[model samples]
Target: MSITNRYLNQLGPQLTERDLAIIRDVGRFKLMSGGQLERLYFADCSDTSRARNRQAVLRRLTGHRVLARVGQRRVGGAQRGSASYLYTLDVAGQHLAQSTSSRPRRPYSWYEPTVAHFLAVAELYVTLTEAARGGRFTVLDFQAEPYCWRSFGHRTLKPDAFVQLGVVHPDGRRRKGSFFIEVDRANQYGAKIETKLPQYLAYYQHHRQTWPDQSFPRVVFLAPHEQRVSYLRRLVAERPEAQRLFTVGLLDELVAVTLDR
Candidate 1:
């Protein structure tokens, strides 16, 4: 059965229950709204009769003390529109109101490599640079590549593409210190990084040993693809050191924002 139907059925004959359930299910309940009560049942009533058997049903279902009003709308015939109501569920009936505290998390979906992805990536990087501006990394030292790593060891380390940020001196000077980023999608393993990992490792080792005076730029591994994220989790489980030198992040959780916004 539909959610609304099930809610109505669960309400049973209690008018308060029905009213609360209907409002909650539809997400349309107001605390101080108004509408005419649409009486489903018909009963004999003259112009002078203030109440009828149908009205009595409401009184019996809800407590007779509850407040209500009568009204109608225009229709083709003189009977006017069917009498249905828009009513408020107030704090006085707090116990009868449904909770609206939480909702399920929105499902995350990856956007495959496309024009949108490319544009989005560029936009995101720019935003990140702006957000991190005036820090150690300078805008002039920032560089982005479409794809730039190659594997070169016995283990066939994977080659991961990067977006880099580096430090620049005030006098238009360039520094050897640079940080790299790797965005993984699908399965990191299946994404073919085995042959290219050595390059990254070599770079990591070189920077660490050679730059005793200056700090090496940090490497960030971002796993946005579900498969890649799963692989990363497993990779980290097997080897915790993966997170030491190169920080890992989930692309799925990264918020996408426009450059202007």
Candidate 2:
């Protein structure tokens, strides 16, 4: 007989089909592994009240072994020092309940997506650095959290990736300075010139002064799509100094520039 049927046989007719359905759904929810299940329960029991209790009872009845500890992905916020724990379940323990798919997914707020994209770009930055014949430079997360404000303070700034270049200028000048790559895949049309450009200008001006060393600080604003290039022109027009500090171009153009290096 099927495992679910065998388990249901013991639970008896007293268990309604609906109850069985719930058990099946709760137990077999393999969409998330054991660790994820534990995190869901611990984060807010209210949301998981029914499922959590059902899972606990089902495990006991089925003689399923519940592993004590598991690791959960880091969740940050006001509870900064807090950590996530995982709960592991044995084969039988995990079997009684059917895996669930309707469970709520973890949310990625505003900055999360931006930071994630930046990390992806940073990986490419590392590859480009290695290929450029420049000393390999480490990617910096200048856009992360509170650091973004401090690093790009006085500007409306969002950076994709930052790296220290190992190559010297063609003039044979000292191999000094780092580069800041600001990626704007789809950021456009927010309050237009009155509000947006000023922010970027401020950020660049502040960023330039923040560094103590004489090393050059350059900005490469990437607009992957052709449609986005117009915004770049507006940006330069509103903030003239940006012409000196930044280069606005499409992804293909950026690729061309980098690949030539």
Candidate 3:
């Protein structure tokens, strides 16, 4: 019964399967926009009808202290409707997620800086999901953040996301590939950020056979702009694995590159 998150304890009885699925998504993605939720879950409804229904579901979760609305209404025109608002799993939400997950997941308290990176990743998630839903691509698996993280020799390689996709070729054949994604906004400086590359290279060097595929996943670095892509490519150029294991591309190219046949 904390002041900020008052208890409803009215958890299980009122929750539907759809509600649980939404919770799982928030837990996995770290954060999501109201628009993302509507697209993923409420697409069955049309226009303003879907907006109203989504607002109701979100209000119900917030009342239960299972989801918390954070920050300002998104700029341009968010609070204007409901779509631009942002959401993250609340303390109670974490407990609800744990009830259904095989492995434990704990969400961090609301903060400002990490939101952009997380939301960027969430958008990629939406793209992949929509493509799969359209029947052209198959999302074999997607693990975000902690689930995608790898620990080897006392260090963890914390890629933004990990995915295995089934790609359909022009010839009507299919192929699969795995990748470790680093969605870089260039937020860090010098050694702090450069450490991630070496960590990934080292992991690839020593742990190739540990994956079920019996080889390391190609490491893809998605940056905000062409210059950023060039910058990351420069970093990759320094490493021996540069030509063999890494790829750097603009963020928007993710779906095309990942699902490329």
Q: Which pairs clash inside model 3? A: none
**lDDT, candidate 2, 110-129, per-residue tens:** 24334334333533443453
lDDT of 1 by residue, 199-229 (tens): 5667656656766676644555566666666
Q: Rank the candidates by lDDT, best first.
A: 3, 2, 1
Q: What tens digits encode model 3's per-residue C-alpha lDDT throughout 2-120? A: 62322434557679988998998988886898899988889879886898999889888887778888888867854445577788888788887777777656676666777887888
Off by over 4 Å in 2: 1-120, 126-130, 133-157, 168-174, 187-196, 204-216, 253-261
Q: Model 1: residues >4 Å from true position, as ranges? A: 1-117, 129-140, 146-178, 187-191, 194-196, 225-227, 252-261
Model 2: lDDT of residue 104: 20
Q: What's the distance in Å from true for residue 64, model 1? A: 77
Better of 2 and 3 by lDDT: 3
Better of 2 and 3 by TM-score: 3
TM-score of each: 0.35, 0.40, 0.86
Candidate ranking (TM-score, best to worst): 3, 2, 1
